[model samples]
Target: MTFFAPRDAETSLHCPDCGTRLHIARSCREVHMYCPACRAHYPLREYIHRADEAMERFLENVYCDRIE
Candidate 1:
């Protein structure tokens, strides 16, 4: 079945300016991110990139035993 609204996925995005956790909803079409704390809208790509970077850092720490 086809859907109109965006698909819900678990995501943890932090505002680059305020460090506030941001919510994400993915869609078949393009979508942008709006941060209420900072009153700014960021491209979806930017949010994804940030998320990727964060995950990479976390994995590195875990593998290197930096996190306990």
Candidate 2:
């Protein structure tokens, strides 16, 4: 069974390897993402972490710009 946050449901997912659309597979503690185009399989946790970091950096930049 696959469970995703409501926010994730709204965004499109793509494979990092082949630029193909990714579909979520079984989900428990970690979610599996598969790329049919490239036969790539990986966990979504890493991608979520990366996205969180990027968002934090972007927010920091925006805050700095506002203060300046």
Candidate 3:
């Protein structure tokens, strides 16, 4: 579960590992993300914490929060 705000709904975000779009689950207490493209899991915010740590920020924002 996550503690994302309602504003997170309209925001664009994605997973750091697979580079797939992600959704904000308010029911969650922390920011958790996953990439359908690669089926990888990672912590939110930290997704883009570094350059070599994950994919490009632009690519991560591609399908961010567009799906549930």
Candidate 4:
């Protein structure tokens, strides 16, 4: 069973390894990019500059408590 549902990145970001589109997924207190084909995870910081609407929303929820 999965706890969180991952959202597809709205940008045209491609995986470096498998050349597959990446998905924005979040764990308890963090968010990152994941490649389904390669099963590899990337740090959010690496893609923040290219974040899309979905990524923005996820970031807001993840950091809401620290915003103030």
Show model 2 residue runs off by greater than 4 Å.
1-11, 27-30, 49-68
Over 1-68, each residue of candidate 3 has an lDDT whose tens digit, in order, gives 86422423312455655546754323334445555456665554554443332244333434445223
**Candidates' RMSD to native:** 10.5, 10.8, 10.9, 5.0
Q: TM-scores of all models? A: 0.44, 0.44, 0.30, 0.66
Clash count of each predicted structure: 0, 0, 4, 0
lDDT of 1 by residue, 1-68 (tens): 97343333324677788877655443445345556667666666665445554344333322222222
Q: Output the worst ten-in-a-row residue range by lDDT, candidate 3.
A: 3-12
Model 3 lDDT, residue 8, Cα: 32
- Candidate 2 C-alpha lDDT tens digits along 1-68: 97433212211467788888665444434345577778788755545444443334333323122221
Output the number of the TM-score-best candidate. 4
Compared with the true structure, what per-residue lDDT tens digits does model 4 show for residues 1-68?
A: 75554444444578899899888876677767899888889987888778777777666546433221
For model 1, give the 10-residue run with minimal summed lDDT: 59-68
lDDT of 4: 0.70
Q: Which residue segments of model 4 deviate by more than 4 Å?
A: 1-11, 64-68
Candidate 4 matches the true fold with a TM-score of 0.66
Q: In terms of lDDT, which candidate is strongest?
A: 4
Q: Give the TM-score of candidate 3.
A: 0.30
Clashes of 1: 0
